[model samples]
Structure formats: structure tokens, C-alpha cells
Target: MTTESAAYTADIEAIAQVVAAVEHSQQHKDPDEFLALFHPEAVWTTAGGKVLIGLDAISAFTREVLPAADWDGKVTYEVVHVFFIRPDVAAVKVRQRYLSPGAESEGAPLYVMSRQADGRWLLTACQNTAVATA
Candidate 1:
């Protein structure tokens, strides 16, 4: 592979790690860790349509919901797609699932991540949409 291609692949892998960290923090119910993945001015919209602007708002919402989540099993987030808007910005599509005893539910989340000057990716904007079934 060309050096440029190899570097691009490395960037994508690093972004995936950041996304996976979100799932890890949520599954472990550590709001601080989850919050750390976002930028200070990040925006998050929940599956239920609540819009949280900025890290403080996001922190408040996550702290309330993550810990009180009633699922018995665990939650997972998988990166389904990643589109690079620029060398420093990407749009990521994620499949989120909650697994419980004899039941499962899912959401599709879109995360807009930005690469910081230090080469770390942080979520800047996100929206979680519930997968509806008839």
C-alpha cells in the first residue's frame, strides 16, 4: 500500500477506536469516560428527540440516562460507515444495540467527528435515531 493510503487507514482506525470508547463507556455506565469522547462544544440529539447542546448539557443528560438504563445485558455500538468530509472531519454511521434477556432493541446513530490538532478524534455532533418496526 502507498504511504498516503496507509496513513488514511490509520486515521480511520483511530476514529473507530474513539467510537468504540463511547460504547465502552456507556456499557460500563461511566458518564465521565463517555463525556470525554466529545468536544467541549459538542451537540447530541437523543433517540427520543431531545437536543443537548454542549458538553455540559450532554453530560447532564448522559449522567441521568446511562446509569438508570434498565437493560439487563449490555449495549454495543458498531461503526457501519465513515465518510471523510475533509482530512480533519468525518461523518460516521453507527449501529447501536441494547441486548437483554430474550429481547433486543437498536438505534442508528450518526456521529460527526473532528480530528484535533493533537491527532485525536472527538465527536462534535451526533444524533441517535430509533429503528422503528411495524
Candidate 2:
């Protein structure tokens, strides 16, 4: 494999680790873990249509909601697709699933992540949309 290809694979692995962290944070109801993935100026839109801009606002919202959230079952997030806009930037498509004995629902969240100078990927901009049944 070419050096460039190897680097690309490594980046995808790093990005997938970030996505896995998102899933981990959600399942554990750890808002701090979730918030730690974002950039300081990150922007996020929730499935419920609330838009939060910047780390402070996102932190405020997550802290208020995540811990208070009640879930009967488990949640999982998968990185379905990754589109690299540049060497240091990636647009990631994630499949989010909420599974329970009573019902199952899904969310499609698009997360834009950036690679920092320190070689860690952080969520930059994101939107979460619920899948609707017709």
C-alpha cells in the first residue's frame, strides 16, 4: 500500500474511535465524555431541532439533559460513512440506534470532525435527525 493510503486508513481508524466514544458516552450517560469530543467552537443541532453553538452552550445543554435522561435500554452508534473534505477534516455519517424491548428507533447524525495539531479528532459541527416512519 502507498504511504498516503496507509495514512488515510489510520485517519479513518482514529475517526471511528471518536465515533465509538460518542456511543460510549451516550450509553453511560456521561455528558462530559460526549462534550469532550467537540471542538471549542462546535455547533450542534439536536434531533429535536435545538441548535447549540460553541462549547459553552453545548456543554450547558448536555449537562442539563444527558444525566437527567432516562433510558430503559441501550443505545449504539456506528460510523457508516466517512467523507474526508481534506487531510485534516472529515464528514462522518453515523447510524444511531435506540433499542429496547418495547420499541426501536433510529437517528442519522452527521458529524463533521477535525484533526487537531495534537493528532486527535474532535467533533466540529453536527446535526442529528430522527428517522420517521411513513
Candidate 3:
């Protein structure tokens, strides 16, 4: 295999762990574990367009949102594209899908991003919304 392929694979593994942490936070409502994967200044936005900034906001939002969700679903993260902004930072476009369990079923592709630093990837910002059709 090529060196670039190997490096990209390793990067994806690291990012996948971060995604798992996010899912764990959602399923179990473990704010500390979720926040550990994010920088103190991380930002999160919901599919409906509400903006949340910083660790404090993220923590609060997680607690508020996760429990209220009747969503017994799972997420699969696909790396659409990655642009290395620097030696330690990259911008990633991802596709996320959630499998719903009940009658009201729907899934959407989200444009999300993360950044790597100190050999770790952290979710810097994300925008989740329904994909528009052309």
C-alpha cells in the first residue's frame, strides 16, 4: 500500500474513535467523556440551525438533547474529503446516517468537520441538516 493511504487510514481510525465518543455521549449521556474528545472552544450546531459554542455550551446541549431523544439509532461516518490545512490540522467533509427504529423514519446527510492537533482529532464544528435536492 502507498504511504498516503496508510496515513489516511490511521487518521480515519483516530477520527472514528472521536465519533464513537460522540455516540457514547449521546447514548449514555456521559458529558465528560464526550467533552474530553473536543477542544475547550469547540462549536456544535444542530440540524435545525441552533448554534452552540464552547465546551460549556456543548456540555449543556448534550445533556438537554440526548435524553429527550427517543431516537434509538446508530451513526456511520464516511470521510467524503480531507484537506490538510497544515501539518496538524485538516478539514473533513463527512456523511452521517442514523437508522431509526419506528414508524417515523428519516435520515439526512450532514456536512461536518473536525481538526487534528497534537496527534489527535477533535470536532471543531459541524452543521447537520437535511440534504437539498437539485
Give me the candidate number with maximum TM-score: 2
Whichever of 1 and 2 has more lDDT, that candidate is: 2
Residue-level lDDT of model 3, residues 1-134, one tens digit each, is: 99988987887677667766666665565667767876778777777788889888978887777667776745455556666665356666665655566434333423243554467788776666655544
Clashing pairs in 3: none
Candidate models: Cα lDDT each: 0.92, 0.95, 0.65
Which candidate has the top score in lDDT?
2
TM-score of each: 0.96, 0.97, 0.70
Candidate 3 positional error at 102, Å: 4.1
Error of 2 at 90 (Å): 0.7
Which RMSD values do the candidates have, in order? 1.0, 0.9, 3.4
Q: What is the lDDT of residue 38 in candidate 3?
A: 67
Off by over 4 Å in 2: none
